[model samples]
Target: MVDKALNDLLTLWVTIEPIGTVVLFATLSAHLPQAQRRKVALKAVFYSTIILLGSIVVGQIILSAMQIRLISLQVAGGLILFLFALQMVFDFSHERPATPEKGHDISVFPLAVPSIAGAEAIMAVVLLTDNHVYSISSQFVTACVVVCIMSVTYGLMLLAEPILRIIGKNGAAILERVTGMILAALAVELIMEAIGVQRWIN
Candidate 1:
């Protein structure tokens, strides 16, 4: 059943990347105490669930109706992702993560936007509605798969607290930089494909 779920939402699961969820959770909750950590995690996850479900329902239709081409969407999404990557790279600090930081809230911004329902996630969902790629029933299953993945995300955040103690803030910051590098590469790939310099490898 786990395999089946993965198969159904394979594209999205890959783009969403549970590891990325861990990074976002760790980064955003860096400044919170143990008690407030749970509340913040719940809030982020709840916001993430809303965005995921909303995107699944209306994202493709809106994109198609707006006459937005896939290439255009890719370029746009990629740029957005690049900006997000930049944010992650510079936001990490060596000091202990305590007290609320200005302009950076755990509940929104990086967590909900590019973290959970980021540009990659949105673009992949838009591409999922292909006629030959999957059947309608399969697509519906994928939507349910989206929900399951988000539920896992919620659980992962709560779990991040203890994990944070083990890894420490420095380790989490290193992970964030690595993910940023990956996202930067992904962004370059999108621009390449959009410009006809490359095509799907797989």
Candidate 2:
């Protein structure tokens, strides 16, 4: 149980990547007032938490109803996450939108969606709670880990201002790029696992 909990926590942490989310949130909400930043941070975290929890609850049912296999979902999610990571790595505007129209209500856009509760993260939670592999109690524990991760994410976003003060724009940009690389690697690993590469090798 301890091992499973620790593994779930680490998986959730990597997939969610709260530090990367903090950098992006700080960059996007830098111009807003302190109160507004707080609101945006809270909303983003709130929406993301809801999304992850929903995925944990109903995502498997939806997939099963559609007769979709978990391996297929893993491959699809990897592809999507790879594309998103490319955007992060190559698109400067994606990191910090210059226009208000593009940046408006960023909490719901990139922040809550692909940034926090991303395809990879959603797929990960579903896979972790696989009915064949994990019991109800284990799945419930995984859900709790998801909430804990989101809580930490909220705390990081709230502290984004002070963290940004230390890192500065250039540092944030570098961090974003690094995060993209890490995500790309993880995506490839997910795809490999979905294809049973490790099992074949063994």
Candidate 3:
């Protein structure tokens, strides 16, 4: 039981990538005041918690109704993650406007959906809490792990200003590219596992 919980913790940690989220939060919220930044972080966490926890509870059922296999979801998520990683590694949005558009609630769009609780993260929690593989009690444990990671992500986002101050723009850029590379590797592994290539290699 302890091993399972530990495994769940690690999987969620990697999929959630709190450090990467901190970089994103720092960059996106740089223009906002401290109070507004905190609110963005809080709202992001709130939205992420709802999305992740909801997936834990009913995600599989919805997938079943749609006849979507977990492996299919894994492959699709890997592709999406790979594309997003490419954007990060290449800094595709480097030429975009410095300021986010007015009336845009970033907390809901990029920050909440794809940054903090991304496609990979959503698929991961659902896989971890598979009804056939995990008991209700075990699923509850996984949900707790999700909340724990989200809490850590929120704390890191709260300290984004200080972290960015220490790291500076150059450091953040370097870290983002490095993280993109790591995420790309993980995405490949997810795809391989879903397609059973990993088992063949092993």
Candidate 4:
């Protein structure tokens, strides 16, 4: 049981990589003062924690109530992931906001919500909470894992200053594109598996 829980937690981390979120965060906080940047970074991680944990607890139910099939969700999530990844890989998108306005408030928009705890992240939470694969105890353990990941995310964001310098704007953009590609591939795999499972059940 311990081994399984650890494995699931690790898998969850890989699916929602902290480093990528850290990079995006560094990019977003580029213009703010060190103190202000730190504050924004903290808030961004806080928002991500709220969004992701919410997804873990009630996201699956919301999707069900919306009548969105898992397969469809996969395909749609794939597209979004692909776009985000494409930006990472190709280095096409502006790494930071152009003109670099001072004291801009961008913690919640692209940084925290979609970039960090985006659709793919929410999907991972829902999948992790799947009752068919994980027992009640497993679900509870996974929730604990989410809490730990949130801590990790907050810690990573706090180091946004050094992280940004280490991996410059261009480097960060490239990384995001690659992450997007991986997310796209995962999304495709998920849709395929859902189709196969539905077919078997039918």
Candidate 5:
């Protein structure tokens, strides 16, 4: 049980990448007022948790109904995550506000969706809870791990301002780029695992 818990914790932590979320959150919300930043952070975390938990509950059913294989989902998710990482590393579009008037409600756009509850994170939860491999109780435990990781992510977002104060914008940008590289590596690993190379090696 301890081993399962630890494994789930580590898996969720890597897929969710809370530190990268914190850096991105800090970068995006730097221009907002303190109260607004807090509100956005809370909403983003709440929404992401709901989305991830919902995926854990219904993702398998949806996949089965669609006759989709977990391996296919893993590969597709890896491809999408790779594209997202490339955007993080090379795209400058994220630097522009959605609209000049009010700026985008980034809480929902990037923060909640791809930043916190990303495709990789969603696939991770579904894969972890797979009924064929994991017992119901073990799946429940994995769900709990997901919540714990999200809680840690929320705490990190709450500290974003202080972290940004120390790191500054340029430092945050560098960290984001490094995180993108890590994400790209993770994506490759996912694709390799989906194709059975990982199992062959083991």
Candidate 6:
């Protein structure tokens, strides 16, 4: 159980990407007053919690309803995650928001949706809490882990300015690229496990 929880924590950390999110939050909220920035951070985390928790609860059911197999989703997610990792490693600039879109809530648009609770993150929660593979109690534990990760993200966002100043843009880019390499390896492991290659090798 401890091992599994640790694995879940690492997986959530990679997928939820608190460090990258902090940098993005700092950039996006740069113009806002401190009080407003706090509100935006809270809203982003709150919205992300709703989206991610919903995915944990009903994601597998929705997949089953669509006649999709977990293994299939796992493979697809692995591929997508790999591609995302490549983007992170090779071209970090693509993720940075241009000036906030007019009339759009930046908190919900880029921050909550893709920054905090991205497609990879959503797929990760669903895969981690698969109905067939994990018990209700296990799923509940995973949910708690998700909340913990989000709390960390929120905390980092709250400290974004200071953190960014300490790390500098180049440092953050280097860190993000290193994280991308780890994520790339994890993506390959997911594919191998989903395809039973790991079992065969074992």
* Model 4 stretches with alpha carbons more than 4 Å out: 70-105, 164-202
Worst 10 residues of 5 by lDDT: 95-104
- Which of 1 and 5 is ahead in lDDT? 5
Model 3 clashing residue pairs (backbone): none
lDDT of 2 by residue, 1-202 (tens): 8899999999999989999888778766765667878888899989999988888889889877999876786787678778867876886464343334644577886689777987778889989998888899999999999989999999989988887778876786777677778768877887998898979888
Candidate 3 TM-score to native: 0.71
lDDT (Cα, tens digit) per residue for candidate 6, span 50-116: 9899999887788779987767856876787687677767874565553444666878856786667
Tens digits of per-residue lDDT, candidate 5, 1-202, equal: 7899999899889878898888778866765677877888898988999988988889889877999876786787678767767876885565554332354467875688767887778888998888789898998898899889888988889998887778876887776677678768867887998898988999
Q: Give every collision pair in model 2.
A: none
| Model 3 whole-model lDDT (C-alpha atoms) | 0.82
Alpha-carbon RMSD, each predicted model: 4.1, 4.3, 3.8, 5.6, 4.2, 5.8
For model 4, residues 1-202, the per-residue Cα lDDT tens digits are 6876787678778766788777666655554567877777777778878887787777778878998765675566555546655554565644455433465345775567555676666777788778778887878787788788878877887877886678775665555555556656655565556468647756
Q: List the residue pairs that clash in candidate 1.
A: none
For each candidate, how many residue pairs have backbone atoms clashing (under 3 Å)?
Answer: 0, 0, 0, 5, 0, 0
The candidate, 1 or 4, that scores higher on lDDT is 1
TM-score of 5: 0.70
Residue range 1-202, candidate 3, lDDT tens digits: 7888899999999888888788778766655667888988999999999999999999989988999876786787678778867887998876544445686577875678666777778889999999999999999999999998988899889889787678776786787788778768867887998899978998
RMSD to the native, candidate 6?
A: 5.8
Q: Which segments of model 3 are wrong by more than 4 Å?
A: 69-103, 166-202
Q: What is the C-alpha lDDT of each candidate?
A: 0.71, 0.81, 0.82, 0.68, 0.80, 0.79
